[model samples]
Target: FKLSLLQIAEVQTQTYLEWKEVHPPQLPKDAVPVFDKKSKQTLYVARLEDCTPCFYDSAKKSCSVSTFHGEFNLGHTVQNRKISFLLNKDNFEIFEWKKSSFGEVPPLPVETCNGYFIARNDFGLGYITDNSLITIGAKKQDTTENEVLTLNHDIKGQHLTITEYQIGSAKASENIAELKHFTASNKNCEAAKQQVKLDQGIDKTVSFLKTRTHTFGGTGETSVSGKVPLIISIGGKLGLKYDYSRLNSKTTSTVEKSLHSVSMEVQVPANHACSIVINSNTFTADVPFTGQLTRVYNNGEARRTLTDGIYSHQEVAEIQALVNPCTPLVDKKRC
Candidate 1:
């Protein structure tokens, strides 16, 4: 069965309420404590004022409020399935009752008590008028009056307790390697200055659309992996050409490994548009390739817009290039 949004919300609400029943949440208490090893110390004293929540940071070993609300000896004693608070009787049944003969009936009033003591921890037993030392049961369900905990007896005291405490770990340091530059164009400007090897007998025409700043070392390759419409300019007329690499295995295999090296003759257009023509296949459609390029212009006054569209992860693998540092001259107006 399908559940509505409201039904999903109710399921979450019921789960939270069920969890809160036995597992009383840790109240924020910032009570600073003064421990005395030589003498007995009253860890906490609860009253009407102690009803307010407290904030404590155990890692810092510091607290904000002045009173510990019975957390020291009875922190983990509370569970989730035992909430037993009473509803306020005065606010109960605020809705009216309507009768067929008399229209509306008068509300009934009577003295009522609704507050109930909860047994999640030993808070109810420790509320004494006289200032006296009290201890809670360790495992056995015993509620005696004003019991004093002792190390000599096999009570909760002197038992090894596993607690979560905070410890100072680390701080970050400056990186040693330099950062690379990014650009709008598909190619790096400075990288155009480096030489690319063309297979001895192959005649290749390569072009770049945009220039980016990058580091000095890396390998480069190109390949086509999809079906797209190919057009050619013949006799000053644009003509449509069909690329059948998808249907024929021999044609697709040969085109996939064909080498068309990048050259300096081809410049990236001002708006970062780039297109290359290989013998029979036209490369206006998107193809994924990883290569290296260097920073072209680092002049302070030089500014150009990038024109490459970011592709989806399923469309292509991210290209990695070894990038070098390209620091431009500082400008008095802006750097």
Candidate 2:
């Protein structure tokens, strides 16, 4: 059966727990997170690293085959993981498995046109078998609904990975997309929600879509790292709003682009702090659509300038909502 991203995530989490006792990650100092509104019962914090993302592993459990953009490579060790097997973008072709020295192959190649190469040695050790000659999308997979197939291979070790050879990739891996993680609310605590604004004025922040992680040491200093994490909390549920009047620049639009209210229940990870960040391209009011559950980081330094982007009526309202903890919470939007 095919697995969705969330399903894959569950498997990853289960795998992590099984291995947690064997190899626990030393949480970084700046990896700690702070709550938007501190409370005795429940606090929301962000995380930096995706403890588990989907990747392919060999049947022998020796090495894995993974795709990075148009290029592919063997996710063997940290050193080779960074290098791409297919660097030239112009050569974006795909490959097929004719025959392997390892054993009888599954009919996946017939169903799905392309996937990683696998090689096995006499010792039963498997490495990413090579097929460097083919370009990424050169050959398309069989489009027939029955073309999709799943196979389980026992090469050597006790490890296993579900490889989707020919099926088209999912949208969750798309650029400029939204990713969300929802956790159960803390027991008996009032639910937390907020409206996030995007900083559209700043091209850099929008371009980079910064990724951040906040690590808090036992000390008071909340050491934030990565791009600046855009973290905030609001009194109500999270939603999107627009001001079309300001679309022309001189004045604000009374009619907003189409405000969307998302009534989502958020549940954070246990014993894990969340993170936040502001990429260089992110501007005043642009809210993040991707990786909602992922944590970002903040510098914690006071803003030198109130930021001109915040002067806009729409942005001002969002800002007030974010910093409401300090004051009685006044509505800043005149419209």
Candidate 3:
């Protein structure tokens, strides 16, 4: 049997009694009326909400709202058999509901949660609290594939956890590999510039290094383990904020092989605006003023400022080229 637009609401004990008093029992078509065992009165069932019809169960002696299209009984709960429904056929499919060992309803599918998500490949973790989400561990999936596996755990009966995994897509894997290569190239460039600085002891070498190594969309990769838990927190009225940290990464291209660290902090006010500050130091080269940049976004417009104020017009143009490589300096108004 098939039913459309099914909605369920719990009945309060008092409300049920009042409803029983007002509308007495009546025999449904092709079905006999069932009387309450205690009251010995015929029980009446009425459509409380918008639906098709109601059904009287002879054995249970209860009337429940239901719809019928064929021989199957629609919108009625049955023992040992789970009920499922779907709206807008393309988006979802009907699935059976499962209960935990304690007879409680299991957590709903993770896709049903509405919020921003950050994942690496298919597996990721996240924490949600009051309009804010703190994503830790690996990144989350960014595709439409249904092969994701998510494990949820309740910690000490106080917190909710979500862990997701899926087969990595080809494009995603290629992107990750490309990022690693770009990081290696950037490392080599930074090392060459630092050697020039040490050998010549001149600021001119720094200028040349900054210009030659300036590349947009080529940031290095941070080594992150998938075992780290993803924390998600939601439900608040305050502004949104994010803090990301990755430690214990080393350069893959250099002989010295010093540690590489990256951290990012972002703030978005409740008024729907964003401000960001990024700081990093790699290979002992002061590329872009020791790797620091600040930006503010409002109403789809962006304004960026350099933290270190020691650069000529040509140098500023070089930095601006890295920031917005496609837009020429002559056309840019804010930098």
Candidate 4:
């Protein structure tokens, strides 16, 4: 019931494990360096492992991460429950059907609607697109364009929202942190380094995972009212061990899940206008010379649901985040 059909959660463990065996992920060759306003002198990430320099710090025989605040869902919108997920397991199946469906189904190729819109990615769990800017769940029930959301926000629910946010706020460094000694790990390419706790808040996440047993609601009836971890891991494998329990109850049960993700960054070339268009809106900003942005995931859980033939049960787990970058390095060329 965990990864149910409607869940549409990305199942990349097997695929990533296979890919890692062939060419295990490397720390990003270069970390977009930054100038730390608090320190005056630029705080550059100078760590690496497995012959690759991490986006944060993986070399210098140590692991370091930069922490920042970012979120996925604003806790104000509701995601639509997809009926298509019930019939397909992965995107490949969906793609196969679309390729031969004779135009009956719209083929979702990264961008759609002649570039008018794109899929909404919620970390790596799932994504969606709608005809409206406010999305389906944000509108009042009586509105003319009101549409249905998931079971959590159908007609029965009231004043509900899907809130995914870190409890703090931060300004991204005006400059990117440089990746020094990129080739330093080459000579000692025996094993990857382990995680180091500097400013990164990994200990906080681990503490929450172990001590907290009651499942908190993530979307409806949930708010960011507790201490949240600002640091996260990326471009690395996460050995996620979560507890599955009934909502608002003390009873629990479950196992561990390992997720593999490639580190990713998006940067705008200098002197060229860079902008991103989403739906009907456009965003323009002044990015520094080191304009690379490393993707980050939250360090909390979700209120994902499970169902038997007769009833559905609600559960919660952590999510993805951005920045305060810290990641683990394992053997077999993993970092």
Which structure among the candidates has the greatest TM-score? 3
**TM-score of each predicted structure versus truth:** 0.12, 0.14, 0.15, 0.13
- Per-residue lDDT tens digits of candidate 2, residues 108-185? 221111343222222121212132222122221112111111222111111111121111211111112222332222
**lDDT for predicted candidate 3 compared with the true structure:** 0.20
Ranking by TM-score: 3, 2, 4, 1
Instruction: Compose the digit string of candidate 4's lDDT tens values, residues 1-335.
Output: 01110101110111000001112222332222333222232222221122211112223322222211242222221122111101111111101111111112133332211322211111111112233222111221111221111111111111111123221322121112221111112113343332211121111111111111112222212111122112122111122223222121111122234432222232322222222211111111111111111111132222222111101111112222223322222332322
Candidate 4 has its poorest 10 consecutive residues by lDDT at 10-19
- Quote the lDDT for 103 in model 3: 17
Q: What is the C-alpha lDDT of each candidate?
A: 0.20, 0.20, 0.20, 0.19
Clashes of each: 28, 60, 23, 29
In candidate 3, what are the lDDT values of residues 1-335, reduced to their tens digit? Answer: 11011111111111001112112333333221223332344423232322212333445644443222343323443233221111111211112222222212234321212322111112212222222222222222122221211222111111001122221210110000111101101112111211100111112111101111111111222221112111111111122122122221111111111222322222222222222222211111011122122212222322221122111110100000011111122322331
Model 4 vs. true fold: TM: 0.13
C-alpha RMSD by candidate, in order: 29.7, 27.5, 28.1, 31.6
- Answer with 1 or 2, whichever has the higher TM-score: 2
Off by over 4 Å in 2: 1-84, 87-113, 123-335
How many times do residue backbones clash in model 4? Answer: 29
